[model samples]
Target chain A: MSKFKKKTATSQEIPTSALPDIIFMLLFFFMVTTVLRETEIKVEQTLPKATQLRKLEKKSLVSHLYIGKPKQPEVYGTEPKIQANDVFINPDDVVLWVNQEKDKLFEDERDQITISLKVDVETKMGIISDVQQELREANARKILYASIKSVDRE
Target chain B: MARSKRGEAGVNSAPMADIAFLLLIFFLVTTTIATNKGLMLQLPPKPDPNQPPPDINKNKRNIFTVLVNSQDRLLVEEQPLNDVTELRSMVKDFVLNFGKPDADSRALYNSLPNSMKSQVLRDPNSSDHPGEAVVSFKTDRGTSYEMYTAVLDELQGAYYEIYGDRVGISADEFRDLDRKNPEDLAKYEEAREGIPMAISIAEPSKVGGE
Candidate 1:
C-alpha cells in the first residue's frame, strides 16, 4: 500500500508551471497564421492538392471565383454553386460580375487582373466550363486554379 | 496571515495565465489560415463573331493533344493512357524532341552539353523544337475538377522540369527564384528564351457529357 501510494502520488498537482509557456506558444502560432477572412464562405470547399503551384501575387489585382456545393444542401439543394463576394453568383451573371470587378480596378492594372478559381475537387466541369466561357466573354483572360501545395507526388 | 502582514508582499501572478489564455482564444477564433497559390493559366480571347477565324497551319507532329472524357479517362495523342503520372515524362520528351531541327534549334542543340545532347531523341515523327511544341488540353463537360487539375499540374510540371534542366537547377529551386532579382531573372530568361510554356486549353466538348 505504501509503495503504490508513493509511486502514484509524486505529482498530484496538475503542473501549471508550463501552462503559460504553452499558451504563449499557441498564441504566437495563431498570430502568425491569422488572416482575418474578409467575408464568410457560404459553400463547402476542399481545395485540390498539387505539387506544382505558384504563389498568387498582388492580392489587389486578384479576383476570386468560388465554385462548390452549398453548405446546407437541404436548404440550397444539391446543385453546385458559384460564389463571389460571399454571395451566391448565378452562372448567367458571371460575365457581368467579372466586368464589374474589372471596372473596380485601375484601367492600366486591369490587364494584369487574374481570376482565381477556388473549386471543390468533386465538382463537375460543366459549371466551371460555363464560367470559363463567360469569363472569356468578359475578357478576363488570365485565370488561376487555386490548389493547396503538397510535397507528395500525388 | 503573517505572510500577508509582511510589508513587502509579492504581487499575485495567478491571473497572468488566464490573460494569455484569453488572448490566445481570441486569435484562434478571429482568424483562419489563408492560402492563395495556384496554377495560373491564360484563356483564349473571345473570338470575333462576324470575321472568319484565322487559318493558321500547324504541323501535326508539333501538337500534343491530351483529352479527358466524362469518366476522367485520358486519351493522349491518339493512344489511351491509363495513368496520369506517365504524362510528365511523355510531355517532357515531346517538348525536347528535335526531329527536324531548324537553324535556331540546331544552334540551341549544339549549345547543350554532350550528356543532354545524347538524351534528346531525334524522333522525326515528333516536334522539331520546344518553340513549336503546343500542348492542347481538352476535357469533357462532365469531367471532375480533380482530374482536370491533376492533368494541368503534370503539363505545367513538365515545362518547369525542362526549364530547370536548361538552367542546371532543380524545379523547386527554379520556382523559388525571385522574379525581382536581376540575377535570377537573367537565369530564368535564359532557361525560357526559346521555349515558351504554350499550353492551350481547348473548349470542352459536350459529347458523352452532362
Candidate 2:
C-alpha cells in the first residue's frame, strides 16, 4: 500500500512541475512570432471637418511631409542676431530625402507613388502650394491632404 | 522492478492519448498567420441621391484624360505621354480657346455668358463648344500617394495660371466678396460657377495588376 501511494504522489508532482515549462514555451512562441506595427510620425494639423469620411479600402503608397516651424538657427554671439529664413518655404528637402530613400520603401513600380501633406492650419497656403508644385515637377501623383477632425466641445 | 498488475487494472491510457491528438489537430487547422503590406487609400464612392454629379464628359478633343496606373506611368487618354511638361501646355491651350456658348443657351442659361461659365455647366466629355474641359485621373491600386499628389499639383498650377490668380483666392475670401459687390460677384460667379476645370479621380479595377 505504501509503495502504491508513493507512485501516485510522484506522478502528480511530475505534471505540476511540467506546467510551468509548458507556459514558458507558449510565451516564447508568441513573442517570436508577433509582428509589431510600423511607427508613424506625429504632426499637428486641424483637418477639415467632414461628416461623411470613409476609410480607404485599397493600399496606396504614401510619403509624409510635415510642415511646421522651421528649426532654430544656431547662435554665434551673446545677442543672437537673427538671420531671416524663408517663412513660406516648401518641404522640398523632405521630398528629396524621401526620393533618396524611395528604393527601400517603394517597389519597382513608378505609378505607385503617393505623397500626403500634413500641414498645420496656421501654415500659409503658399507653403502647401509650393510643395504641391515641387511634387508636380517630380511627376508624383496621388496626393492627399491629412487633417484631423475638430472635436466638438460641450 | 516487476509490473504492478493489481493497480494497473483500472487505468485507461488509450482515451487520454486520443484526446491529446484531437486537441493538436484542432489547433493545427484553426491557426492562421498573415503579413501586412502596402498603403491604404479610402476612395470616394459613387455619389448618393442628394449629391450632384459633376459632368465628367466635356469636349472629347479638349478633354485630356491622364491615367496614372499603380506602376506610375502617365497615360493620356489610353496613350502614354512622352514628357510630363506637355500636360501643362495641353491644359493651357484648352482653357484659352474654349469657344463661346450657343446664343440660345446663353439667353436661356444663367446670366453668365462666358465660355468659362458654360464650361462649368457642361460635362467634361461633351462635344459642344464652350463646354468645360475634363481632366480624369484614374489611379491603380497599390500606387503610391506621393505620385498621385504631384499630378494634382501640376493640374492645379495649370488652372491657376489661366484663371489669373497665381495665388488663388481663399474660399472664405471668395465667399465674403461674393456678397459685397454685384460686378465683382458676377465675375467671381462666372469664374467659380461655370465649367471650372474639373478633376475626377477613379481607381483601377484590380489591385497590383492581379
By TM-score, the best candidate is: 1
**Tens digits of per-residue lDDT for model 2 on B1-210?**
356754665755445545554554554454433212112232333345587877755446656677776566788767787665577656655554424556643543444334434344343343233244566766664344445554654565455444433124532233234334787666565554444656655534354541
Model 2, residue B71: distance off in Å is: 2.3
**Model 2 native-contact share:** 0.00
Every candidate's lDDT: 0.88, 0.47
List where candidate 2 sits over 4 angstroms from the true fold: A1-154, B1-46, B49-59, B99-101, B104-127, B165-187, B207-210
Instruction: Name model 1 segments beyond 4 Å from true.
Output: A1-29, B1-11
A19-84 in candidate 2: lDDT tens per residue?
A: 445544555555455544242223333333321122222234555555543333242222111111
What would the TM-scores of all predictions be? 0.87, 0.35
In order of the candidates, what TM-score does chain B achieve? 0.90, 0.49
DockQ score of the complex predicted as candidate 1:
0.57
Q: B1-210 in candidate 1: lDDT tens per residue?
A: 877776877777678789999999899888766677898888889999998998859999999999999999999999999999999999989998899989998898887657567779889988989889999999998999999999999999999888888889978778777888999999889888888899988889998666
What is candidate 2's CAPRI-style docking category based on DockQ?
incorrect
